[model samples]
Every structure is written in C-alpha cells, then in structure tokens.
Target: MAIESVVVRQRVEDLDAAVPFYERLTGSTASRFAFAGVTLASVGPFLLFSGPDEAVRRVAGVAATLAVGDLDAAVEDAVAGGAEVVAPSAPTPNGHRAVLRHPHGGVYEYVGP
Candidate 1:
C-alpha cells in the first residue's frame, strides 16, 4: 500500500491550551473531534489529542500516524515484516487505525481511508 501522509500526534493535557499553539504553528485552524475520551484536532499534518492520562498514555511517544492506501494490507505487511500488532484495525473518525510495533521496536499508528 502507498503511504498518503504522515500525521504527527501530540498528546497534551489541555486541548484548549494546545489548539492555539498548533493553529499558529501550522497557520491553519484546526478541525475538532472527540473519540473515546480523547479530544482531537487536526491542524495541517499535526493531530493534537487531549484526554485522561490513561487514554493519552496509550499513544504518547508514538512515532507517527502513517496514512496509507489500504489499512488491511498495511497491517498484513507489517505483521509479515516482523512487526507486532498493538491494536487491530478499527474504525475512527477519519477512517481506520491499527497500532503496530515495528521490527526495530518503534511504535506507530497506521491510518487509511
């Protein structure tokens, strides 16, 4: 599958406080959404998420979100490449997402339309 875009996710303690900074940094207003308990905003290629410690912790320090052409194929390819599945493919506001630990031990989320 071809990678479409790379989204940088930043886990923050306060969505209100974080949005302005990213908006200025990206020079664009953010599109907001809520998933599970997390408040998310998309500004340019950045995705800012804020929520409870537990929910945010799960994605903290993740390398990046790899937007791809095929979510299923990407997951399969990741597994075949010695990556470990952290979260199976599931629906999200944008599309679908699956977390994986690359063979070299980097954690990332794969997203697709």
Candidate 2:
C-alpha cells in the first residue's frame, strides 16, 4: 500500500487555541472533525486533538497517524515487517483505523478511506 501521509499527532487542551497557530505554522486551513468525542483538526501534516484526558490518552501513545492508500494492505505489510496489531481495524469518524506496534516499540495509527 502507498503511504499518503505521516501526520504528527498532538494533544491540546483547547482546539480553538491550538488550531490557529497550527494553521499558520503549517500554512493550511483546518479541517475540523470529531472522533469518539474528541475534537480533531487536520492542518497540513499535523493532526491536533482536544478532549477529555481519558479519551485522549487512549490514542496518545501513537507516535504518528499514517494515511494509507489501502488500510488492509498496510496492516498486512506492517505485520509482515514484525509489527503487532495492538488495535484491530475499526471505523472512525474519518475512516477505518488500526493501531500497531513495531518490534522496536514504536506505535502508529493507520487510517485509510
């Protein structure tokens, strides 16, 4: 599967406070959305989130969010490359998602249309 993007994930206390600066820094307008009660904004290569601490912490371990051309193929490739599926594929507000952890202990969230 082709990797469409590697978006850095950041947790903010307030989306409104965080989005404007990220927009200026990334030079892209925010595309706001919500997932599992958390507020999210995609600005350039960054994905900013704000929500309850418990909800946000569940996804905080992910080093980055990968946008893939094909989620199933990406998951297969990752597993073949010594990665473990920490969270099985599931539908999110934006698309399907799966979380995986590599042998070296890096965690990533993969998302696709």
Best by lDDT: 2
TM-score of 1: 0.88
**Per-residue lDDT tens digits of candidate 1, residues 1-113?**
67888998888778899899999998999999988777899999998998888877776758899999999998998899899999899998888999999999999999986
The segments of candidate 1 whose C-alpha lies over 4 angstroms from its true place after superposition are none
- The regions of model 2 sitting more than 4 angstroms off are none
Which residue pairs show collisions in model 1?
none
State the lDDT at 79 in candidate 1. Answer: 94
Say what the RMSD of model 1 is. 1.5
